[model samples]
Target: MLSPSLPRPLQPRANEVLPARLALSAAAAAEGIQLLTRDFAPWLAERGRANEFRVDRIPFADLDGWSFDEESGNLAHRSGRFFSVEGLHVTEEGQPYGDGPYADWHQPIIKQPEVGILGILVKEFDGVPHFLMQAKMEPGNPNLLQLSPTVQATRSNYTKVHRGADVKYIEYFVGPRRGRVIADVLQSEHGSWFYRKSNRNMVVEATGDVPLREDFCWLTLGQINELLHRDNLVNMDSRTVLSCLPHPDAGAGALLSDVQLRSWVTGERARHDVRVERVPLAGIPRWKHGESTIEHEDGRYFKVVAVSVRAGNREVTGWTQPLFEPVGLGVTAFLTREFEGVPHVLVHARVEGGFVDTIELGPTVQYTPDNYAHLGEQGRPLFLDTVLRARGDRVRYEAVHSEEGGRFLNAESRYLIVEADEADAPQDPPPGYAWVTPAQLTSLVQHGHYVNVQGRTLLACLNATAVKGA
Candidate 1:
């Protein structure tokens, strides 16, 4: 059996090759064609070029094998030629083995489209130096690993012999979104089993020094895929499950086994497991900012009339090491609901399609029996309308009085201030304070009135009247 010697210290500093292999990313993949599989090719087309995971052929030399399914019996007929792997991680000894020559090897967790788990079995044959890796894929894919276990087979060669190398073997398992994962065994039990692994967190490192040992079997991404296959027509929701690719290129190999399987939709990876918890947003404080009622964190002053919430995940956009990371959070609110007025609410402002903050919407003019529909509702329309009336934008208006107690909100006369979008709008410039001009002072004494525009004088007009001029 292969025994890997590990470093005493887990942390490896700067640009070291040891940490590089631990980095299961689009760029660092070099060991297996696991990245080149058809499912992964297109997913990382842009990323492969960016990261250089693309290669002419798949990595890892393929070993002959056989496959079995509990429901279908022997998939490989008499020759259960199992697909095995060579030159992969050996965790028999312990962690911190001398840095392996090719540092790209990683144990990826893959989920087929319709099935519960298409687990990759990371194992070593009895006293053998080679590593055995297996995966289950859709039948249509061109390259198929024939030596696979029977579907729902209890004796399907499944077991987690060792947890000793988890820190080292799996290093860091990360993904773009959320999904449920469980550990299973090939047993006679009727139902499948699951054990939570991790949530959608970006991996700082994906590979590590896998200690080799006879007792502990290596858990490869492919082997996990096989153990999860279901025999009957089962449905799965892909929205909640995360399928990991070894390299960006390896994304090509993944495929959903059954078309009808369903999975739950999830938001960005909140916890370590794929099963998303329903957070009670009841009375959860609405999005707030500094003293303003913003619909969201951004304090734009739009009235929020509606808000929608849902959950899902993003695929790999190239990252530093592990390419997957949870991008955004999910909402418990849904757009469509059978029941009227869903308890979970979002502020949909009376604004355009994009996010409109509730703060921008003026105070609800809840004048009962009189909908303020006449004012052409816009954000802070009361203020805007007042500006229009004061600056002679309107021909007529009802003069109203203001209360001494009202700070800014006045019922009788609502005084509003508005800034123009452009320069063409008329404005009553703020009352200017100035000393009387020498010419205007003399005119004021001569006549009782004075024209205010640009300091024009009524004194000249009155003087003309006194002189008998028209």
Candidate 2:
């Protein structure tokens, strides 16, 4: 073997340089080198027309290379790769926050333990940071195309399990020649739909010349921020990766200190007891497998269905897979209130059955109104009405965004940021709720499993829109 050489410096030259650069990028609102801000939507539409994309719902028997196992009744690929649809039984105990002392539910969950990469490549253009983004097509998306990250790929796709074309710009995230890692953390997905699912949310700074593809463009963070205000433009993966970017500590002060916030979250997790187990999908209760879909008896929650997808630009030109389609639109919002002139958002420590951890910080209101229609007015979630009835003047930001299109079909949530008063949401809120500054939430997002996927998306909205409480 050759003689060993000295390693490079363990610490970077500038300890806090990346955050400052990111702040500069966040402040830059103009269009970047390759794409104009106004043309982004039109360009995405053009890309949609360039491909032969089709998604037709089919029965379980028509799925190609995919089938339900005769033994377990789990819907999976024949190769035993990618993800599988399995049944989950969850029981919550010990002072559950919303419902009662105890609660339980049975649902189908997507189980994909393999960690995927959701990365955004950053390269400076003329002293300003510009991010590499892709116009990707997902069959389950309402529009079938959205602004995605530079590289969004599962282990099976990146590892060539599908025997398809290479994932573009993946080397910058994984290989030996990978760029300088600015931010990298494992972030959770929709805990309600997925079972302990997490992806590697990464942002890397490219040091060398990078080639551009037809479907990819370089955008400043501010441009992305402007685009975020639009409906279903920026995809969920891009938003989550953007949330991991470091923010400056410019807040005047927060109601809760960072240590207090962490302690509160930990307390929330410790007080709740949640037990979950995987069961065969063959005999899950309250669900029936029909010819076209597996649906709930009451027509609430979501259903699992199969689709045949054909796209020209994807790694694999054509494929068939299953998607979880929610029954109704969801409303996910954060109620913001000013404390000592500092803006703080109400964060609810929510417990979902599929979370690896017992609980994660969710938005002030995250629910599908239709699912709770049976409960009537008294049973409606707290602050949900405040979000729904807020006038235009009190609404700081509002947009309709889709969930992970790769797994969800038309799963749209009306995301909002509404101003609230002490009368609406008190200073000393009820248990399982706390007011934290956006910067504090951003700090927690740097680590894994602290905030849920919906929380991250709202945090990204605050970061992008720079919304300040009046």
Candidate 3:
């Protein structure tokens, strides 16, 4: 047995260094490599059939283990382990910069203080790093089946609070005999829909013999990068984990130095004063709770609706829960431009009521256009028109991706990277915007609460498409 008081080394041996191996795999990746499996779409369909996955919207009264608390009107599970739907009252003192009309509003937010695990396991095959991915079913995904991490579970899930099947490959992430930890960090989730929510994003490298399940498959990093260009092929959890991988090099120089960029983000957080309060969900103003849903009076934003899920491969085969459904398709894009031949993307310091830190670096524009149509030209976001009206020649990358499928219903966003000139987006842009290299953003993502989920997704895209030798 190993000594409990042994001093550990700070760094791995030179041969075991991770970045070199990752770069090797990434550089060798081709757009259409058929090494492991052929046609992911058909394989996903077969898995769907094997799992007998099904989800249907049901009345609140039909929830099996969930009920509306009589005292606070919050929707929660009887065990109080998974998550709950509560109300948040936000009050912004000044005219915060954004497309939304109100600085103050009341809405239902998912409050899950527990930090769950979103881990992806990696192994070497013929000296190339291949990631283990699962064909998971989430009720909120538009297609109902997408590629997810090797082990995605809540504290309640792994702890057996739901009293279901054991999470496969979980031992590789949690126990003493677990795999080598490549990347492990606590990252934030959807701040708008979740109250101070965060999940542990991890990447582990397995060492010993592994039992391959029918629902799981191995693909190289290069293959995963190619899949990133496709719409909703890789789930949000996988994207966030991939973004945390050590990048090769973004560029030699940036418009703003790393110190200056840090100062700017700090100053953005200091300038805003937002007050948020947790209130009873029963009688929140401007929201009406019907038997089937709880939505805004104007039919904008999102609503809380109940769902019944039946999956053959989950920890639990059947369960009832609630999911947040957005009103329309959202647009999330990065405005990229070269400064002295060094590529940089515009980032916005955005504020959401449910965020624990009050602000995070988001994309240049992240909003549903339909939600802001009534605001007209004067109320439009700074670069919304530019992204929406860009010609084909200026577009770099475009794909439709969905949010966290387990808790969100059809919350898809048209993710893009649109090039712009000085006339469309100036160097001395609006107050809340700044330009930073993709490497700088990835550096910040290594820490928590710095880059939001949307920004991370775009950064992953940049790593795959824009960055040379990345």
Candidate 4:
């Protein structure tokens, strides 16, 4: 439990202006920065020399005690503690915890004893808000130190009984004077993927001069947005939190009014409907669950496999969990064009089985070739071909980046940005799709609607200057 101490108000800094040249060069990360990236090591070393920061990776074998059951496909702690697998539970009747159509399916859930806290600290600088971010390393991440939240701690790390210390800055979140809660939502992890249902995500603003750690940095919303354009620069946790930032309607540059966009979205909701039927794991067509791996008959789409992880920063140094492995690179693309001088991305209303909301906003193209081919003939996603084959001057941004390394094993995708002519874009897009401006999308992101993870990731990749000019 956090100490119930009142936070002191933040004091103003003498010179809040950023240096003309950043110590960490974004150009050095042009080839995609990660833990293993050559340039990243030097940059980190420089920061380390100047500040007190350290990151070390530990192998699962070096962890205290852990075990895996090949027969039952269960991963457990040798001491019978923390998280463990309790086999598969089949729910024929809908349960209160899960109200989705996944009834009657064999769902594998990790019995975790503690819920984690994913909180972001915010402060005002020069009347502009800035979020305190960390360059933290996770065992599963491809890059060593992707941008992470100020305080990301599981129950074990934060509680005195577990790790014997409190998570830093957690008092700002759980204790009194938690500042104005900008975004407080219980966002679920991958439902079809992770056993952990929802992690508490919160964004709070404090008005006081807080002590700075060597690994932490304060970034304006604009600067953070600029960093989003780079591949694998921002971690999934940060992107999800950024997706929840509030956007006022007064500064929008779109020709369409908020009422008009809302009306269009409402009409789209009525136009398309999604139905997900839960089938038993054993009965799933062509899928075979073996002692070690789960795969489809065609050897495509995705496979589930267990992996042991060790991280010095985490509460527990060692643990095992099943990760999702894709057959090939997935593609997520957005087609943007000027909408009365404001850039509007072609958004799709997509339905994922794991999502609480049946339909959420996604990019114009979000699919793998194998999944796209499996969508039958007519069920294929719209504008996928156009985006895939997009070439010449229309291609604005294209990069191959790894997925969330924590949950996904060796999963990556091609994130694309394409420019289209308004005249060429469809006036009457197919049901469940809309052309929403960057401002409108930002507003929707605040409400946790109109944009899904894939969409938000792509939105983060938008060039601020390019969008402003468009």
Candidate 5:
């Protein structure tokens, strides 16, 4: 049940018409382009006085005594052994690792001990807020050197007390100069499978002159936004943190009046009912967990598979886990059109089985049909056909990025932007949907509602062309 103190759902204002065109000013447009073209990798490498980092995988045998248990449907480590399997336990009451006297409905959780910190250091230059980002390499990323957070460290690496190695610039976060907290939230991982969580998402403003580190570069919000238009250029963690940056709608070039938009959002929020119940991993219908794979009866959605990993930068040189593998590349997109010259993207209020919130705003289509052969006319993903059949010219931005490398072994999705004609756009979108301005969406992001990870990832891709041209 929703708490009583929570604000009432917003309702649409009657007969309020939105503006047709809401274009960005000339200054904003120039800023967007500047952000897109700024080169940071070469500069960072020169500063560090080193070659760009390289990442490689280690052999499976290097992981000491790690094995999968067919009987319990869990991964295990033998005594006196240490691997990345972290903590193994049930989620009934947040208990520690052990054989569980678990309830029938209890879900298994893999609590990775490394409490990895996904921290970004922010500094001001030329009176504009600039973020300190790293051109870091991940073993699983298609482009090895995508932009990463300034300080991506696990708990073991950051805390000297743990006898782990030291993390660079760790003082900015934990020390006396931890800067202002822009965003700090404990976002959950893929909850259906791994219960791994991290405390690393933070954006702090530096007060003093902070030394620049090798492989790290300073970027403005506009630059970051421009970089998001390219595929795999920005990592998932960076996208999530970037989504948390507060974007207050100045009402500049807004298509809809704030009142009307709020009403529409509130109406959509009231239109759908989402039901979620935790079930035992062993009892989910039409699913089977084998020693090698977790699959649906139809084998169309995703699978869980074991893999070996080795990384030079991670706390451990090697480890293994059952990672979620999508059978095919999925598509996540937003359908946009100029309404009276103002651009608005179609946003879906979607529900996922594992989401912390029952329903959050999502892209127009987020799907892979591997196990979902039945998702056609009457499916939850209502307009996927329209999006998939969209013309190539309608595509404004598209890029492929691998999912979380540390968790999922290999999973990727095509993030896209498709333009629709107002004539073809839904005159009245079905229940649980809304046409929201990018500014409104950004405001929703500030409140930390409406937008989901996939939605934010795609939103991060929205560029000056889409922002100004529309």
Candidate 6:
């Protein structure tokens, strides 16, 4: 093994670190690690400099540099491989990707004479990059580089080739100049597959993506997709994907959304169970954004048939919780008729586990800060939310809501100082307020801001005890 300090400015590279029970490695070093780059000399030079090894730099072109690269195509782009297909073998088989027993899905491309695919035809960046097999015409393909987040035990995270979901990889077998450039794709994380062999089929390996508490794949693509969601509610955008995949409401060419909606329920009734469709936020007008909607009848109690709050992990990574949670409560009761204005169905239930998603009985009430100034010395509060709650009988409620803007003036109650569950709440807008409501053990589920004997606006915030499964 190389000395740990040898990486130097190269910032360590995640070599391989699987346990003996799950350890898998390359049999031999016939194929050195694959590095995908347009300019190999520079990359090699950098590595050589770092290693203090000066060897003869002999370079030769495989196909004699005769490529089908349409100058108008990608190799000409500002930030991508500007080369086009020189001597690639263009296949005429309009066959499916492969048979199910072995291969899963494949895209059949009609041989274009010259222009071929649009955008960067040579680049494909979808989700975090994965290991790809590289091969020349004469020699079979072999695993070149694994592209996913790597830890050098101490390196940084990164991706290669494509960026969002719709990149079209260079199909060596059939673009302009095709000569058998087929990718045996293994859908995996960066370090999962440390080796890729040429001519081998795409393999599926089981490994955990524990490196990222950071879901950059979903987060980045979600931003690129925000504009797309403005008008369409049918789908969610996807990450690392070149284009949308097959979804029910999506058109023939719709892409698979990056955000995987694990479960979709109408108040816990579990209305839709399949994956959600991703709508791109691209090109969305300023006036348009996602809004919490409800289908109400004339006189019946407004029961919730749908909700859209951000779930999973219970951790507040984004501000879309209000939009993603209630639809999750599985409410069977008719919603209060008065819930017409900016509806805020804030629940203060305890999460079953740090990993579980179920919201159970607990204590916390929904109310507006007294005059919004209760929140602080504000000239005036946004008064934009209409608070709604599900608590025991005592806590009655009211709220100052704005029907036009559609948002809440409530701040997420959090812990500044750790307090015991049996501990006392501080004097000011009392901290330690729990974020969710427990399922049973009923208590007053107050709505509307109630200025207590004191004047702090957010005094009755909720909190929890770390006592797991108590």
Top of the candidates by lDDT: 2
Better of 5 and 6 by TM-score: 5
Higher-lDDT candidate among 2 and 5? Answer: 2
What TM-score would you give candidate 6 relative to the actual structure?
Answer: 0.16
The models' CA-based lDDT, in order, is 0.19, 0.88, 0.85, 0.60, 0.58, 0.18
Q: Evaluate residue 21 in candidate 4 and report its C-alpha lDDT on the 0 to 100 scale.
A: 16
Candidate 6 local lDDT, residue 456: 14
Model 5: per-residue Cα lDDT over 379-403, one tens digit each = 4356677778888888888778777
Using lDDT as the measure, what is the rank order of every candidate, best first?
2, 3, 4, 5, 1, 6
Question: Per-residue lDDT for 436 in model 4?
Answer: 80
Q: Write the per-residue lDDT of candidate 3 for residues 385-418, one digit (tens) a residue.
A: 8999999989888999999999999999999999
Tens-digit lDDT string for candidate 2 (1-470): 42223212213743457667676777766666677788877888888888888899988889998888898889999899999999999988655567332287888999999999999999988878899999999988999889999999999999999999999999888866677777889999999999999999998888789999988989988889988998998999999999998777654499888889999999998988888999999889899888779888999889999999999999999999999999999999999999998889999998888898899999999989878888788658889888999999999999999999999999999999999999889999999899999989988999999999999999999877672221
Better of 2 and 4 by lDDT: 2
**On lDDT, who's better, 3 or 4?**
3
Candidate 3 local distance difference test against the native:
0.85
- For model 2, the superposed segments whose C-alpha errors exceed 4 Å read 1-15, 99-102, 250-252, 467-470
Per-residue lDDT, model 2, residue 355, is 91
Candidate 6 per-residue lDDT over residues 30-124, each given as its tens digit: 22223322233344234323322111111111122222223311111223231221111111122221101111111111111221111111111
Q: Model 4: per-residue lDDT, tens digit, 59-141? A: 33433455555555455666555566433434333222212223443443345545577788877554445678777666456
- Ten-residue region with minimum lDDT total, candidate 6: 189-198
